[model samples]
Target: MMINSTQVSYFTLSAYFDTGLFKYLCFMIVMSLYVLIVGSNLLLVVVICMNRSLHEPMYLFLCSLFVNELVGSSGLFPFLLVQILSDSHTVSAPLCFLQIFCVHYYGAVEYLNLAVMSYDRYLAICYPLQYNTRMTYNKIATLIALTWLCPCCAMVVLMSLTSSLQLCRNTIYKVYCDTHSVVKLSCSDINVINVYGLIATFSTIFGSLLLILFSYVRILRVCFSGSKQTRQKAVSTCTPHLASLLNFSVGACFEVSQSRFNMSTLPNVLRIFLSLYFLTCPPLFNPVLYGLNLSKIRVIFKSLISNAA
Candidate 1:
C-alpha cells in the first residue's frame, strides 16, 4: 500500500545515536560552530561590501560564496541543534523538504560559483591585456545571476519530484533530510525521478568541473610559456580557489558514497561525521582559506580590525 506524500507527516532520522547527557555538550559544540561560521562568513561579506577598493570580480564572487555558506549553515545547524537536544529525531515533512532544498541548492551554487571563478581567473591570467574588457560589470552580473538561477531552477524541480513521491516509510537514515534518503522511502516506482536526478546532478557537477578543467588547462599552458610574473599572478589567485575546490570535492565524494552505497558496517560515529563533513566544514573552511590566502583581503581585513580596535 502506498502512502501519499501528504500523509507522511514526519521523518525519523535513524542515524542519531543516544548520547544522554552528552546531548547538551553536543548542542553547545554545534552551537559554537554555527556561531563561528556565521560570524566569519558575515565578516568577510561585510568587508567586501564596505570597502570600495575590494569591488572586483573575484571579491564579488567570494562575497556570493560566503553568503552561500550562511545559507547552507542556517539551513542545517539550527535544525541539528534542535534534534540533538530532543529525544525524538523526527523532522516535520515540510521542514525536511526545506532542508533538502537548502542543502542541494547550497551545493549547486558552490560548484557553479567555483566554475565561474575559475573562468574569471582564466581571463585574468591567460588574457591579462584584455581581462578588463572581457570581464565587464554587466558580464560579471550575468555570470553570477546564471550561477544562482540555474541551481534554483534545478532544485525546484528536484524538490517537486521528491515531494510528489508516495512514501511508504518516513525514516531517513541520516542526521538531516536529503534527496536520496527521502527518496529511498518511496513506495512507488522512482525510475523517472531517479533518472532526472542523475541527469541534473551530472550536469551540475560535471558541467562545472569541465568548465573549471578547461579554464585551468588554458591557464597551465600560459603559465608554462609566459614570464615568472605571469606564473606568480596565476598561483596567487588560483591557489585558494583550487584548495577550496579540492576540499569541497572531497566532502562531496564522501557524502555521495555514503548516500548511494551500503555502509552499514562502518561505525555510526564515523558515518555521522563523514555525512556532516561536507556541510559543516566548507562554510568554516572557505572563509578561512580565502581570508588568509588572498593578500588584499587579508590586509584590508587586518586594517578593519585594527581600526575597530
Candidate 2:
C-alpha cells in the first residue's frame, strides 16, 4: 500500500465549536483535562519507580498500566486542544492516519496490559508457590514487549490498507481521526479494512477479555478454597484491578458501538460527550482507583503527601 494524494491532502475535522467564546471555553477545559491526565498518571509511574517496595510484579504492571493511560491520553488531548483553539480543524493526511494509529495502538496495548495484569494477579493468588518462578524479570519484559508490539504490527497493516483506500471525501464528523471514520470516506470497497479491523479488534480486545475472565474465574475458585485470611488478601488485591478493567471495558464498548452502529437518534451533544468520555474517562480515573484502593500504593502516596504537607 502506498500514498496517493489525488483524493485528499487533509481532512476537515468536526465543526463542534459554535462561537469564539465557546471555543475558548472548550479549549480551557480540554487543556486542563490533558494536564491532569498526564500529571496524575506520571505521578503514579514516578512513585512506583522510585519506591523500591513497589518493584514487584504487580506494581510493575500497575506502572505499565499508568504509562499506557498517559500514552493513550497524550495521543488525543494535545491535538484536541489545538483543534479547539483553531478556527479550522484540518489535519494532514499522514498526521491524521498517525493519530489513528497512535490512538488505536494505545487502546490495544491497554487491553493487552490489562489482560497481562489479570494473569499476573492470577499467578499471585492461584499459584503462589510457582508465581515467582513463572513471572521472572525476563519473562515480564517479554510480555510487556508483546503487549506493545502486537498492536503496532496490527495497526501498521490496518493503516497501510487505509492509506491505499480511494477516498470519496475529506471530512470526518468527529473531534479525532479514527480509522473507521476515515475509512468511511473512501470510495473503494472497505471489505479489507472491515476484515482486518475485525481481526485486530478480536485479537486485541476479545482475546484479552477472554483471558482476563478466565484468570478471574480461576482466581475466584482459588479464593473460595483458601482460608479466611487468604480470601481477604486475594480480594483486596483483585478488587481494584477488576474495577479498572470494568471501567475500561465499558468505555471501549461505548466507543466501538458508537462507530459501528447508527445512533443518529442520539443527540449530537450526547454523542460528542460520549466520544469525549470514551477518550477521557479511563485515563483520568484509572490512577485514582489504583492510587486510592491499593493498600501499598495508597500508603506510599499518603506518606509522600504528608511529608510535603
Candidate 3:
C-alpha cells in the first residue's frame, strides 16, 4: 500500500487509552505516580550535588543515574498525564519521535551507568590502594559524559533513519513511541533501520551486562578472600547497587519484550501496565532503595528530614 509520508503528520496513542470507566481514577493515580517519580529522583540528585561527601566516583554515578531517571520520566509522565486527561491521545510526529529518542537514550545510558557504577565499586572494594588514583574526578567525568553521549548519538542516528521512512500507520499501540514501534509502522523497506536498531540494542544491552558481571565477579572474589570488616563493608556497598540493577533490569526486560513479542493475548490493562513499568517503577524505587541502604546517605537524608520538621 503506497502512502504519503506527509499525511502522517501525527500519531494516535490507541492501546493505552483503555482505562474504561475509571478514567478519572486513572488520572489521579498517574498524576500521583508522576509526582513521586519526579520528587524522589530530583531529591537524590539535589542531595548528591549539594553534599561534598558524595562527590566520590560511586555517588557521582548514582547522581547521573538519578538525573537519567528524571530525564526518562520527563519523556513520558508529563505527556502521559496530559493524555489521560485528554479525549484524544494524538501526538505530533516530531514530538513522537522526540519522545522515542528520549526513551531509548535513557535506557541505553541507564545500563551503561550501572555498569560503570559496578566497576567503580569493584575498584574501591578490590583495589583499595589504587582506587583513588584510577577513579579520579577526570575519569568519573569522562565516564559520565560517555554514558550520556553515546546513547544520545545513537538515538539521533536511529531517529534520523526513522524520520525518512514512509509510514503507513498513524496509530501506535504502546504507551509511548519507541524505535521498534515507529520503524515497524514504515510502509516500505525497513531493513536498514531494523538491522541498525538490532545492532544498537544488542551492543548496548549485552555489552553493559557483561561488564557489570565481570565487575561483580572480581568484587565477589575479593570479598570472599577478605577479612570480616572488609566483607561487611563490601556487602554494605554492593547490596544497594545490585538491588537497583535488578530493579532496572526487570523493567528494561519488560520494555524490550513488549516491543519484540506479539503480546496480543494479554489484556489491555496488563499490557498497558507492563509497557509503562520501565518509565515509572525504576525512577521511583532506585532513590528510595539506595537512600535506605547506603549508611551515609541514610544519615544525611535523616538529618534533612529532621531539620525540615
Candidate 4:
C-alpha cells in the first residue's frame, strides 16, 4: 500500500533505542547541551554586536557563524529532547518537513559562510596593505547576503521536492528528520530528485570547498615566504577557521556517507554518535575555539565578566 504525501500524517523515527532508566539521563544531557550551545553562541553574538571596535569583516563573519550555530542546534535539540522522552518517537508531517528545511538550510549557510570567511582571511593576510580598501562594507554585506539567501533558496526547492513525493513508508531510520531518509521512503520514482539533490549537495559542498581551497592556497604561499609578523598574523587568524573547517568536513563526510551507504554493520550507538557529531560538535567547538584564540573577543569577554562581577 502506498500513500501520497498528504495521507502520510506522521513519521516514526526508529533510530532511538530504549535507554530505559537512562532516558531521563539522556534528557538532562541533551538539555544541558542545548543550553550551552545557545548560551555560548548568543554570548559571542552579543559581544560582537555591542562592540564598535569589533565591527570588522572577520568579526562580523564570526557573528554570522555563531548565529548559524544557534539556528542549526535549535532545529535539532528541542525535537531531540522530546523524542528521547516520548515513548513513541514520531513527528508530524509539517514539523518533520520544517526540521528538514532548518537542518539543510543551516548546513548550506555554514559552508557558504566559512567560504566567505576564508576569502576575507585571504585578503587580510595576503594583501595586508589594501585589506581595508579591498574588503569594503558593501562587499561584505553582499557576501553575507548571498551566503544566507542562496541556501534559503536551495532549501526551499529541496523541501518542495521532498514534500511532494509519495512515500511508501513513513518510518525514518534516524534520530532526526533528514532529506535522504525521507527520499528513501518515496514509492514514486525519485531519480530526478536524487540528481537534483546530488547537484545541490555537490555544488554547495565542493563549490564552497573550492573557494576555501583557493583562498588557503594563496594564504599558505604567503605564510611560507612572508616575514615572521605576517606568519604570526596568519596563524592567529587562520587557525580557528582551519580547525573549524576540518572538524565540520569530517563530521559532514561521515554523515553523508552514513546516509548514502549501507552502514548497518556498525553499532547503533556508534551510528548515532557519528550522525549527531556534525550537528552537535561545531556549535560547541566554535565558540570556545574563537573565544580563546582571538584576543579581541577574549579581552572583551573578560572585561565584561569583571564588570559584571
Q: For each candidate in the order shown, give its overall lDDT on alpha carbons.
A: 0.93, 0.86, 0.87, 0.94
> How far is each candidate from the true structure, as Cα RMSD in Å?
1.2, 2.5, 1.4, 1.0
Candidate 1 per-residue C-alpha lDDT over 1-309 given as tens digits, one digit per residue, 9 for 90 to 100: 356666899889999999989999999999999999999999999999999999999999999999999999999999999999989899999999999999999999999999999999999999889988999999999999998999999999999899888888888889999999988898889998999999999999999999999999999999999999999999999999999999899999999999889999999999998998889999989999999989999899788779999
Error of 4 at 125 (Å): 0.7
* Candidate 2 per-residue C-alpha lDDT over 197-286 given as tens digits, one digit per residue, 9 for 90 to 100: 898888788899899999989988987788887798778888888888888788888888888898779888788777767579989998
RMSD of 2: 2.5
lDDT of 4 by residue, 1-309 (tens): 456666799999999999999999999999999999999999999999999999999999999999999999999999999999999999999999999998989889999999999999999999999999999999999999999999999988889899888898899999999999999999888998999999999999999999999999999999999999999999999999999999898889889989989999999999999999989999999999999999999899899999999
Candidate 4 weakest lDDT stretch, 10 residues: 1-10
Give the range of the ten consecutive residues with the poorest summed lDDT in model 2: 1-10
Indicate whether candidate 3 or candidate 4 has the larger TM-score.
4
Ranking by TM-score: 4, 1, 3, 2
Residue 251 miss distance in model 3 (angstroms): 1.3
Per model, state how many residue pairs clash: 0, 0, 0, 0
Which residue pairs collide, candidate 2? none
Total backbone clashes of candidate 4, pairs 3 or more residues apart or in separate chains: 0
Encode model 3's per-residue lDDT on 81-124: one tens digit a residue.
78877788889998998898888888999999999998999899
Give the Å shift of residue 192 in candidate 3: 1.1
